[model samples]
Target: MRDAQITDLPDIREIYNYYVANSTVTFDVDAMTLAAWRSKFYYLGKLGMPFIVAVSPAGQILGYALVSPWKEKRAYRFTVENSIYLGAASTGKGLGRVLLGELITRSKAAGLKEIIAVIADQGADASIKLHRDFGFEEIGRMGKVGYKFDRWLGTVLMQKSLK
Candidate 1:
């Protein structure tokens, strides 16, 4: 695993967009374009956030993890929200644990105090378990907060503190 280069955006988008189109793991109704991903890439760069990707032995990107600003307000600068996506072939092999652990280490090194996880409650049991294993406590849940795949979905809000 290593810091994400700009060239990794397309693969990252592909991984994320797969979930966007085929699963409720993400609430996005439309696929995100490369341009939008570039914008987000730059935004996280400017914030000094950690955006890292896991690569296979053949140099293919297998998964990615990152943290974005939890809120725009200045007082919330020390906190960030986490996002992790793995290619379909990469799941269940402990890649998520490696990616998330590295992300937490980098976030702490970047002086971040908190990491928040906004996870889809449906079809994301593994994610919830992963976060809990990392000491992220479930703070709350929002029911029927999203409509996707022709059904109502909710979100589980989990948080971990670096301090």
Candidate 2:
């Protein structure tokens, strides 16, 4: 994994849109435009946060992982939330594990205290397992807190202490 560049936005958006359209992994209902994605990249860069991507040998972007502040409150400054996405073809190849491992390392280097993953309760076993492998433990569960795909969705809050 390495720092993502502006040129990688298209592939990133494509992969993300796929998830948006078909999965509960992200609650966003609409596929984001290139302009919006550019703004997201710029904001993360300005925040000095890491936005890293995994690429295939042929240079295709296979997946990405990023961390952002968990909340806007001053007291929550030390906590960050993480998200990860892998191309359908890239799943089960250990790419998510690799990306998450690097994310944890970057979070530690940034002096963050915690990495929280808000996982959709549906079809998130792999994600929960991945976080557990990195030492994250379930903190809470908000039942039926989200509605998506014509159904109610639950969320599981998992966190790992980085300090």
Candidate number with greatest lDDT: 1
- State the TM-score for model 2: 0.97
What are the TM-scores, per candidate, against the unseen true structure? 0.99, 0.97
| Model 1: per-residue Cα lDDT over 67-128, one tens digit each | 99999999999999999999999999999999999999999999999999999988899999
Tell how far residue 6 is off in model 1, in angstroms: 0.8
Give the root-mean-square deviation of each candidate in angstroms.
Answer: 0.6, 0.9
| Model 2 misplaced stretches (Cα beyond 4 Å) | none
* Candidate 2 C-alpha lDDT tens digits along 1-163: 7999999999999999999999998989999999999998998888788899998889999999999889989999889899999999999999999999998898788788988999999899999999999999999999998888899999999999987
Q: What's the distance in Å from true for residue 72, model 1?
A: 0.7
Model 1 stretches astray by more than 4 angstroms? none
Instruction: Please give the RMSD of candidate 2 to the true structure.
Output: 0.9
Alpha carbon lDDT of each predicted model: 0.97, 0.93
